[model samples]
Target chain A: MFVIKCPYCGERDQTEFSCHGESHIARPENPNEVNDKEWGEYLFFRSNPKGIHYERWTHDHGCRQWFNVKRHTVTDKIIQTYTMGESKPEDNNV
Target chain B: MKYSLLNLVRNSFSYHENWQEAWSSPELKKEYDIIIVGGGGHGLGTAYYLAKEFGLKNIAVLEKGWIGGGNTGRNTTIIRSNYLWDESAALYNHAVNLWEGLSSELNYNVMFSQRGLFHLAHTVHDMQEITRRGYSNHLNGIDAEILDKEQVLKKIPYINGDGRYPIMGALLQRRGGTARHDAVAWGYARAAENLGVDIIQNCEVKGINITNGTVTGLETTRGSVKAKKVGLVPAGHSSVLANMAGFHLPINSVPLQALVSEPIKPILDCVIMSNAVHVYVSQSDKGEIVVGAGSDAYNSYSQRGSFDMIEHIMGPLVELFPIFSRLKMLRQWGGIVDVTPDRSPIIGKTPVENLFINCGWGTGGFKATPGSAHTFAETVATGEPSKMAAPFSIDRHYSGALVDEAAAAAVAH
Candidate 1:
């Protein structure tokens, strides 16, 4: 279990948060202009990387706010926790 | 070596000291007619059917690690085919049929026990859902019967039907049961090898060689090998492999955990699953009470789950089977499952030509091993989706023709 650091609140138990899957997936700007294949890719396909991953998490029980977490998929080690609009962490080191 | 009474009796004379290897670990070939990427039950079974059914020769099953060491070994070995959707009903029931004769056909004792399976309904909503699915299973020609609380208590006498969540009724599938999971992999490995299929271990795939949108072969750690057709059957790592081939899959790898309690006297005879509580329990042949828990919310490839998941399931598990409250857990482990949005498997051609994929079985894959391989072998051989596999094609994601089993399947995803 992890003591996740929510951006809105301080350190909190992992159970208080809910993961919302891969983050930073920008919906296509013009949905009507995109082809079916492109729209489908945007809708269904995910990177789901095995190493470093950036995903969304909500402090559902605590602050009730959403944020992003940079964590290692293989190690389950959280590298950083930033608010929703921040860019993904640039450093590779944990 | 064909396992038989004669062989057992003859070997007994020498104190059973001389036993041949179940399968030969062959060196990677330069090229082959077909190649299977993972050496789990599905991949080995696919190779077995490719040789036995399709008359295909010169096939190789490449394993990154030892055979059956992945989800094939990690799963709790529960086998049932009472799915609600027509497509899933046909696919999973086909597996149940193949499972019946699997031991005899493989010439190995898989120990497939046809003990009945019960999906207990704890609420009125769960009762309605299961009754609807029970009727659907009957329509699909699969055996199913709804039993009231009293019947459930009579069959499973030790169950706590009047616990915190009272059991209203249950959907029972008499043909559903458990099997020896490791034997399933070894049986298929030996049988496939006997049919002239090579089994290569410790060969990790680094890249998929493609030219002009067509698959040529794979570049592995051992060496690059060529193949006319390749089937990507790797569980949990489907997205990773697809990315190597310049395509993406709608799969997320997550950890699902299962644990077994210390051995005791044989007390439980049937599999009991409570979908609302996210717990399933069955007694293994060795008397260990095997328990399955729900997946963790976040994606992971760590092959381990949070401790809270165990705590969460144990509450309802003890509530359902009060006698198990004092039993000590023996071992706990996790397997990365490649889950799809619709909670159904994907078994058909991919965007890359000559490359087929059989993945996204998620939490309920072990039950469909034979059928998944049987239909997948046909798909890879003919370079077209088999009739049974056509409904589960990757195209369905775009076309919105998904066989949504998450809603109706007894086991919670």
Candidate 2:
């Protein structure tokens, strides 16, 4: 079992957390203005990058707070764990 | 000699040393009518159908590793067509039909056993969902029966019918069962090879050479090879291969792990799946209790899962089968599954011309091998998606017309 460093709860067991899939996929500002294709892309498409992935994880069992995690999808290495509003760190140079 | 009793006896007369290789290792040709990347079950099956059904002889299947060395061999080989959606139900039902005759059609023993499959209901909601899907299956002309708690107990005597997640009922698909995973690939490879299809192993595709939005050739580890058409059946590597051709797929490659217990007497004769509790178990022909669970929460291509995942799944399994608490797990392995948002597959032409892809099978591709290949071959052959494969086009994502099977397929896959 790996540990997830929740921005609020510090390091905790993975069971305490729940993944929220790929991150940085903001909702469209105005749904009425968006076309069906754009709306679908917003709703469905994801980077799902093999290397570095920016995802959201909620410390549901612990702090009940959600945060962002920049982890490598292939290596499972957490490059950084930041708050929900913080921009993704540029440390995944590989 | 053919794999028959006469050949067996003939080989026995010579100390059983006259056996021929099931398939040939042919030299890669400079160019082919079609080049199928990834020599897994789907790729080999596509090649087999292309040559056998479509009458396409100049075909080559390129594998980065040996055939069936990927998800094809790693899956827990459960076959069922009791999907929730009509499109999926129809597609999987077609696959099940093909599987029933695959052994005879291929002239190879694939060990297709219809031992039945059960999806146990752990909650009232689960039972309701089962009832709903059973009705859907019925409308699709698929065989599905809702069994009460007593029937589940009768079918699986060892299961703790009254555990924390008590068994309320189950959805039984009597025609669904298991097949020897590797044999599916080998049978297709051998049959495809017999039809003059090249099975080139250890040939990794490095780059896709496309000109004017049309696929021209592929640069491989062996060398550059040209093809008029290309089919990508690379499973978890679908996104990676698509990236080479300047396209991105909404596919995530996640590691799905499964384990097998040591050989023992057949405790379970049929497949038992608990989607609510997240565990699937079936006894192999060799008596090993095969257990599989949901894919790891995170994405990974390492072909391995965390110990926490195994622990999480084993708890529900052991709770259901108290006798298996002591059964030692002999082996554990993982496969990278390419999951799509809809949890269904994408089988049609891509933005690139002369390039077709059949992937996004996610956690359940092995069961759909034959039908996937049969339709994929037609799609590649005619440069148009067949009636069976038309609904699974890539444009579905944009059109918001999705075959959503995510919840139903979650743990059961």
Candidate 3:
């Protein structure tokens, strides 16, 4: 149960939170151009990397706002937990 | 195990509701040897064990509302022990063991059943995780097996099996199942009440009267009550009660919503979970298809089941159980869950003397009732945590020793 430090609400339990997978997966601008496989992969595949992972988080129990978070997958540590509208994460930090 | 860890975990006491115990009277008995708050399963179960196992009586259980009125009654009423981690695996297995014998132990039918639980997986990764968890739980003495799509189809033909959100594989456990939620609570309540523990209801606790860093007693709706020991089991409302005592709890409260389709023929035998959809389903004994979704990120005390939640949960349900699309939506409700930073529950003592806590069940609380209550009672009586709970102490969070339960607490659980 990682205690996420929501920027809006103080630290909250992992249960009062939702994890939106792989924060930087942008949808292809041309939907018709992407094949069915690519679309499915984009929708289904997520990096459950053992190391640092960029993800979107929602403080469901407190603010009800979605935020971007740079979290460690292996250690369950929140490197940086921020709100939803943040810019795409820099992969170098991960 | 470090005794300090048990005492410290209560520090992240995510108590959000007012301490409104419907039963309290200072003048009647100045002080009892022990006090257990929140007369739900854990509190009452603690008293029962204290008297039967520890040879201790004179216990009091105070509840603001009727027994099992909290998450105990609100939960979807399912139980399983397939876990990836060692600490949680053993603990839940022990709880399942207790459930096997609980009907005879309580001498009242709690409607306990071992109808089996099947974890549905859509992708190879989910199947691998299930395999990992299956091995872990098996090593911890749980009975688990792997099932392919053909086996799943054989078990319940009603489940949809298209390549879209296809069924890659599953983790089947014959030992895990559900019981009557209200009956389980009432069984514990009546049994504990009969054992001479003051099962006080309609009593609200307002404040914990302390002095010099010691828990003297508590001021409640009825009156002041003194006690040598106090345990809080307020569930989602756990944080607010902790605040009155000046405890800095790290947990936040969230409303977890669940809905049921109108009564249909019982199609699902074992529990069903969709890793791709993040939705799980199981039909109750009453024929209502109980479905739950992950919590919506945000804080609101409201219990109104959202349209968005239905839409989000339904997408997974229809993909998995096509029959559910036509089933009329029945009653939908929400319960406040006291979630901990690490998806695991904080079930131990507090820093203050004579003050013990058992909040932070999150979504994992119901599956852990027997073991949690057993070890929690042991801790409150002896002021030490059991080996099973040593890893989940609240102090670990402060010391960067938090138990990462992302793999364990995922909706796949």
Candidate 4:
């Protein structure tokens, strides 16, 4: 277990936060036009990479806000954290 | 050398020094009819069956590490077939049937102890869920029996019946039990190698060579190897491999941790699993209590879990079995499990031609090793999923025909 710098609540234990996997998947604007495969891809397919993953986390116990975390999947190290509306960081050196 | 009494007696004359190696580390071949990625039990078993049953020739199994060094050796080794769905029941029960004769067929002592497995219920909802699953298992010709509190206590008197989250009842699958996890891998490897299937270790697949959306070969750490029909069985890194082939699997690789307590006199004779309490424990033949905990909240490939997970299970473990309160944990390790949305495995052809994928067993792939390899060999050989594996094809995610076994998974995700 590690500490998470929650964008809204500052630093907190990882237990206080909940990870909602793979952030920034936009829903189709015209859902009625998308085919079954496209809809399924949106619903199920994930880019579960071995390294350099951008994901969502919610501070369930502390500030109760959602944010994005750019972490290394293999090392479990958090490189950066930003609020939900903010764009992904350009420099992902880790 | 076939392992037998005569062989044992013959080896004893040489002070057990002249016994041959179980399997050979052959040089990588340039091409083969089939190439199985990953040297775990599932992959090795797939190669074995492809050669033995399907009469396939020139098959190879590539391993990034030593054989059975991945999740195959890391699982808790709890084997059971009492599933809630008909599809899973059929699939898992096929493994159970093969497991019954695996030791004899492979000429190896896998030590499969069918000491019974009990799924305890602590709450009303758990009771209902297990009752439904037990009936479903019976209807599917698999064995299951629901026992009330008295019957549960009568069988396992050591369990605390009046503790916090008291045990109300349990669903017992007498045929379910543990096996020697490493032996299962070694046995399959040796048997597969004896059938002329090449077992190559320290061979990592660096890239998938796909031409015109069909798998042609793989570039490996050792060298490039050609195989038109390739079966991908890399368990936790499945999505990584899929990405190499211009596709993605609906999989999330997460760490699942298990620990064993210091060896003591045998107290727990059977496996006791409580999904409600989130603790499963079984005593090894060497007398250490093997305990399993739930997965961590976040995804990880670190092969280690949070300390809170230990505290989480220890609290309920002591509540259920006060005897284990003082036993020190000997060692703890984690395995990266490839979890799916519906908690069922994906065993079928991939989008890339001649590329078969057998993965997404999530937290319980070890139990389905033999059955998965058996059916997957057919899928790889004929480019079509066997009847037993058809329901678990990749198309299920699109058609929404999921086998949904999250409840019966025995671990609360």
Candidate 5:
């Protein structure tokens, strides 16, 4: 079992948080502005990187807040856990 | 050497000293007609069928590690075709048909057993869902029967019928069962080797070389090998390979964990799955109780899951089978499963020409081994999706036409 250092609540068991899938995927600015292909890509496509990955997590039991986690998929190493609106870290070394 | 009773006796005469290697370890060739990446069961099976059925010689299967060391060996080894959709029924049933003859066809005993699969229902909704799936399976000409609690109890006497979630009814598929997962990989490897297919171990595909939207070759850890066609059968790492090809698959990789109890006297003969409980149990021929759990909450290429996930699954497992409460877990491990949004596989050509992909089986790929290989071999050979594989093309995602199997898959896979 791994521990996720929640941005709101410092270092919590992974069970206290629920993965919200790939992060930084913003909704379409205008619903009808894009074609079906673009809309689908925005809705479904994901990087799913085997190395470093950026994903969202919700601390369901701890602080009950959402945040972004830059993690290494292969290593299960959490490089950084930042607030949801923050940008990806420049040096995502994990 | 063909595994026959006569050969067994002939080998016994010399203390079994003349036994030949099941498959040969060959040096990677500079060029092959077709190259299959990820030397798991599906890759090995694809190579076998490609050479035997498609008549393509000078083929090689590249594996990063030894064969069957991936999900092929990590799965619970349950095989079933009782699906809710016609496409899935057709595809998986095709595998069942091929599985019926896999042993003889590969000249090796895969130890396929036809013990029925019982999907237990703990609630009325589960019963309704099972009934719907049963009818859908029957409409697709797949074997399925709805069994009440009495039948379920009769089939499995050790289960707690009156647990917290009382057993209601089940969907029974008599053709569904389990097989020796490793033997399957070995059998296919041997048969493919005999058919002039090179089985290259420790050769990982680092990059896919495509020239002008068509296939050229692969850059491997060993060296670059040229090929006109490349079929990717990588399970959880499909997206990683797709990235190397300059494409993105709508696939997420997660760790699906499984555990086995210490060997004991044979008690459970049939496979039992409970979607409500999120656990499936089956006894191996060697008398170990194999239990499968759902995927971990997060995406992970690391084949380790959170310990609480195991703790959560074991609660329901023991609640159903109280006798196993004291049984010690011999080993626990996980396999990375590449799950798609529709819970269906993508088989056929990709955006890059001549780069065929047969992946996204998710947690239920073992049962589809033969059918996957059979159709993939055809697709790669003819540069078209086979009749059975047409519905699973990647274009369906864009067209918004999917053979959704979410309800059928549930948590069992």
Candidate 6:
């Protein structure tokens, strides 16, 4: 078990935390309101980028709160970590 | 005179009689109202809820080993409701709600800490996924954001930042978090015990006690336990237990592994997951960096997590976070995961009457603990499936109603 630092709690084991998926995606209201075409699109599509990328995640085992993180694909270096409502990073030519 | 004596005791209604029946031995004691298989979080949690919610007294949770000793205790303890599928998203959203109140609701400490999680994207198409998934999440009342380079660097800051993979942006869930797996199990066990539920550890179900395709009880390593209702909550061993009942489930047990770095002053705060890298990383409160990846491509119940997974992950892991190279490896191990065709859980009734199942929890079961238990319990007590959890039923495979979570833009992408 690796030690993960909680933005709220101090550094703890990875066992004490859970990883949410790629961060920062919004859901629609009333799934029935959305057409089957949209629903199918929502279920089958994902951006499997190759380099540096952005996504949403949650620490299910840690603070139990959802947050955002920016990480690199080639290096795995977490470039940025932010709470919701934070502005997105400026577009950069990677 | 005997009748008069009986009436005299009845007349003494002011006090209740302590007619306690003592048992001979733990090994010899058998016979329970409910015999639940599997000791993972779902099984133990089911036992807790059955007694607490449904008032199903005389319940026994039979674990082959110890409580929480299975995947319920071994997984990367994360929870979220950002699923792309409505059947799953709605249910998991409810699970997040329960996780919010479980500590106080159970009157036991679950230590559910919501630290948020960020899934990194490395391409342009990934951005579109984030947008689409974000829409679905909003529909389910969950929020996810798209983050760009500077913002990503500002929060994480330890990246190579070269963006060789064209780090476009990410889907962010601000409410997801983790909890202690062991504590989660212990809390439920202690609570279930207090409610008179028997947690029989080290007891394996050797034989199925069934009557004409319907389960009457079970013959375990300890002894025979007769129950009117049964629930097979075993995750990895789900197929095995299902075989015992003369039925087949579409589940394969795969070995999933994870490793941790030695304790160091924390560097990362938020949990990081990358489908491109196929390695997920997060730092715990104790300073160890827990790292995990997908299951081994082989089929086996072996609990020995192979070095192949760890060594293979280094390429992506280091690529994402170069500084981890300096970190020392502490421990590495594997847990058996029950995989389904659609990567969804099987949490409803089987063809066998009175024999309910809550298995088929593939790689992503830990997050679905509360919701799995809530619906599974309802299925067992009432012999009816829950609408919220119905999509995950075993019947779906036969009926062709699969809940594929492949889309949702941000999940497992």
| Fraction of native Cα contacts reproduced by each candidate | 0.80, 0.59, 0.02, 0.76, 0.68, 0.00
> Which numbered prediction scores highest in DockQ against the true structure?
1
State residue B111's C-alpha deviation in candidate 3, in Å: 1.1
Alpha-carbon lDDT of model 1: 0.92
Q: Tell me the lDDT of model 5 at B121.
A: 92
Model 5 C-alpha lDDT per residue in residues B1-413, reported as the tens digit of each score: 88899999999999999999988888988999899998999999999999999788889999999999999999999999998889889999999999999998998899999998999999999999999999999898999999999989988988999999999999999999999999999999999999999999999889999999998999999999999899999998999999999998888899998999999998998999888977889999999999986888688899877788888768988999999999999999999999888889999999999999999998899999999999999999999999999999887777778888975666536
TM-score of each predicted structure versus truth: 0.98, 0.97, 0.76, 0.98, 0.98, 0.75
lDDT of 5 at B138: 83
- lDDT by residue (tens digit), candidate 4, B114-144: 9999999988888998899999998999999
lDDT tens digits, residue span B180-207, model 3: 8887787776666556677778777889
Report the number of the highest-lDDT candidate. 1
User: Where's the lowest-lDDT run of ten residues in candidate 1 chain B?
Assistant: B404-413
lDDT of 1 by residue, B1-413 (tens): 78888999999998988878888888998999999999999999999999999999999999999999999999989999999899999999999999999999999888999999999999999999999999999999999999999999999989998888999999999999999999999999999999999999999999999999999999999999999999999998999999999889988899899999999999999999998876898999999999997898788999998888899878989999889999999899999999998899999998899999999999989999999999999999899999999999998888878888876664554
In candidate 1, the residue pairs with backbone N, CA or C atoms under 3 Å apart (3 or more residues apart, or in different chains) clash, namely none
- Native contact fraction of candidate 6? 0.00
lDDT of 5 at B37: 97
Residue A50 lDDT (model 3): 34
Which candidate would rank higher by lDDT, 3 or 6?
Answer: 3
Q: Worst lDDT window (10 residues) for model 4 chain B?
A: B404-413
Clashing pairs in 5: none
Q: Can you give the DockQ of every candidate in the order shown?
A: 0.83, 0.63, 0.04, 0.82, 0.76, 0.02
| Reference-based lDDT, residue A57, model 3 | 76
Off by over 4 Å in 1: B410-413
